[model samples]
Target chain A: MITIVAKSIVKEGKLETFKALAQEMVEKSRKEKGCITYQLYQDIHNDHVMTFIEEWEDMESVEAHQKTEHFEKNVPKMKALRHPSSEMTLYKKYI
Target chain B: MITIVAKSIVKEGKLETFKALAQEMVEKSRKEKGCITYQLYQDIHNDHVMTFIEEWEDMESVEAHQKTEHFEKNVPKMKALRHPSSEMTLYKKYI
Candidate 1:
């Protein structure tokens, strides 16, 4: 299994709208095949630092997720509402 | 439950030692009373990036963990081997 830790800092005043739009994306992402977990999290110390903690079967699954209609539709919207500090790290179980 | 995503960059050449030292801590942490998950992961794209994905019953359980013998003994060593970029984020489920 592969795990992905994604962090994106939202624009100064678009938190609510970003989350509202994410609601649908999250639901759809969770239902995708090979997706084990697709959940959103808000940083306890910083409200603007939102994260997506995700798990998938493998690289193939991850690519599949990126090509989905939900991701296609929401990513553009999300990108427009976020700063450039977004980053994602993929990891494999070590212990 | 609370989930924690902790990122720590191992010092230039101490990755192997850090992982070896973490072996015992990971075992002991998983055996803690309220720990649901206490596992490690190495970033696939960047070997220097390591992440600890944790789950605990609540804030009290989390506090208890930091005070445990294993954490106390190992953290200082780990800190000495890590860069200053280490940051930990606490998150509550938001799916």
Candidate 2:
């Protein structure tokens, strides 16, 4: 299995904008064939920090996700609202 | 459940130190009462990027972890090995 954790800092004052986009992204991602789970979370202490937890069937599906229309389309727009900084990590499940 | 994904940039050349600390942390965490899973992953593309994904029974267990001796002992040392900068997120599991 493959897991991805994406963290981003939303530009101040754009919290609602980010959430709306995330809602769309999560809904679409959860319906994909290889997607096991897709979840969104925000820090209780820091609203600006948001994260996405994803589990996929394998690395191939994860790579394919990067090319999906939902990802390519919303990501650019979401990036615009971010703090010019973000990070992504891919993991091959290791218990 | 409370899930935590911790991302940290190891100080240059401190990969071994980080791994040793992580190994200790994961082993100890998995034995704790509420811990369901504790995992560590390194970026396939960048060795400097490392992440820890943890699942717990509840927020209380996660909060308790912060005060655990293993945590208090290793975290400071790990922090010292980290790039002066890093990030941590606490996720209330939502799918």
Candidate 3:
């Protein structure tokens, strides 16, 4: 299994809207095949910061997730809704 | 090997403070033995959202980290300065 941790900085005043979107995204992602868990988190120190912990069965499933409509469509919307320069990382299971 | 994904929601109006903490934590963690990578991220849509992606050589290392002064001390401060809730998960590498 592998885990993907994603973090994004929202605009100065979009925390609420972002939270709603995150909640929705988490719900949808949880139903995907090979997804063990998908959770949305808000930083206790930053009102505009959010993160996600996503677990998948393997790389193929993760890659598939990228190709899904949920990702393709929402990514643009997510970008449009956020500040520029969001950070994302992918971790391969080496253990 | 293993990966730990941690998410925390800072109280409203504490983004900068939390970011600084996260930055310091990441820096300290990266230098530890068995740590492959430790990165801090802020959500693009929420300033209060913070996430961490930590890769370790094994569960033993991870457990050891928990006992480090860096963790034990900061954790309480982390808990006290926040909105009272944070989420953390450990992932075992199966791939």
Candidate 4:
């Protein structure tokens, strides 16, 4: 499985809109094939920081996910409201 | 559930040792009560970065986990081998 840890810092005054977009993306992403889990999380210590923890069956599935309409539409919108320090890291299970 | 995303940058020359210590912690943490998941993952884009993704039943369960023997023994040792940018974030499910 491949896991994605997307940590985003929402821009000031855009929390609500950012969340709405994220929730919509999450709901749609969960329905895609090979999706093991896809969920949104808020940092307990930093309210402006949101995380998307996603588990896909394989790299092929993840590639397919990028081509989906929801991804194409929402991701750019989300990025426009994000600050520069945000990070997206791909991970492979270890140990 | 409470999820912890621990992203640590291993010190130079400590990758193998860090992995060994992390694997031992994963093995023990998995046996703790209320531990839904305890895993180690290597960053696909950066060899120096390792992440520990942990899920527990609730706040109480997470508190209990901090007091476990494995935690007491290994965490500090692991920390010593970590670089300065390491972060540990607690998250609450938002959707």
Candidate 5:
């Protein structure tokens, strides 16, 4: 499986909207084939920092997720809510 | 539960040592009363970049984890294997 850690620093006052949109994305993502897990998290020390830890069956699945209507539509909206310099990393299980 | 995403950039040639030490830490951590999950991953695009996605029952469990013999002994070793800008972030489930 492939794991993705997506981090973003939200623009001030956009957290609630971001969360709502993210929830919709997550719900849709969960229904996709090859989605093992799709969940959102908020930084405990910094409320403005949000994260999504996702697991997919493989690279094809990830690509499929990116092409979904929900993803294509909402990801830009989500990005608009974030500050510059936010990051994402994809990892392979090593242990 | 509380989640922690710990990222580290391993020093060149130290990935094996870091992984071995991390495995020891994960095994010990999993036995802790409040540890829900403790697993390691390596960035697929950058092999030297490692991450630990951990889950604990609460803040107290996390504190207790830091004080354990395995943690106290191995964390520094892991740090010594890492580059200077490695980061750790704690998160609370928001979805």
Candidate 6:
């Protein structure tokens, strides 16, 4: 399985909207094939920082996820709510 | 529960040693009270980057963990293995 860690710093005053969008994405993504988990987290120390920790069966699953309607629609909206330097990295389980 | 996402870039040639140290930390940490999960992951796109996704029952549990012998001993070693600009963040689950 592969994991994706997508972290971003949400712009001030846009957290609620961003979160709503994220929740929609999560809810839809979780129903997709090969999706083991899809959850959103907000930094306790920095409320503006948010992350999505996701588990997928393979790279194909991840690619497919990006093509979904929810992804295609919401991701750009989410990005517009974030500051610069946001990052998303795919990881291979090591332990 | 609270989560912690610790990301770092391991120095060249230090991945193996870092993984070994991380494994030991994970084993010891999982046995600690309030620890739900403590796993290490390596970035697929950048082999030198690693991340730790952890869950704890509360902030106190996290504080207690920092005082553990295993944490004290290994975290420093792990830091030494990493390049500059590494970061550890505490998060509150929003979903």
Index of the highest-lDDT prediction: 5
Please list the C-alpha lDDT of all candidates, in the order they appear: 0.89, 0.84, 0.71, 0.93, 0.95, 0.93
Query: What level of docking quality does candidate 5 show?
Result: high
Best-to-worst TM-score order: 6, 5, 4, 1, 2, 3
The DockQ ranking, best first, is 4, 6, 5, 1, 2, 3
Each model's fnat?
A: 0.92, 0.58, 0.00, 0.98, 0.88, 0.90
Model 4: TM-score, first chain: 0.97
Candidate 1 structure quality by residue, lDDT tens digits, B1-95: 88898888999889988988788788998999889999899999888888999999999999999999988999899989999978888987766
lDDT of candidate 6 at residue A9, scale 0 to 100: 97
Model 4 chain B lDDT-worst window of ten: B39-48
Two-way DockQ contest, 1 vs 2, winner: 1
TM-score of the candidate numbered 6? 0.96
Which residue pairs show collisions in model 5?
none
Show the lowest summed lDDT stretch of 10 residues, model 6 chain B: B83-92
Candidate 2 vs 5: which has more lDDT? 5
Task: Report the lDDT tens digits of candidate 3 across residue range B1-95.
Answer: 67677767788877666666667677777888889888775554565766677779987788888888778867776766577556775655321
Q: Model 5 Cα displacement at B85 (Å)? A: 1.9
Which stretches in model 3 have alpha-carbon errors above 4 Å? A1-95
Interface DockQ of each model:
0.82, 0.55, 0.05, 0.89, 0.88, 0.88
Docking class of 6: high
- TM-score for each of the candidates: 0.95, 0.86, 0.52, 0.95, 0.96, 0.96
The lowest-lDDT stretch of 10 consecutive residues in candidate 1 chain B is: B86-95
After superposing candidate 6, which stretches have Cα over 4 Å from the reference? none
Give the higher-DockQ candidate: 1 or 4: 4
Candidate 3 DockQ vs. native: 0.05
What docking class should model 4 receive? high
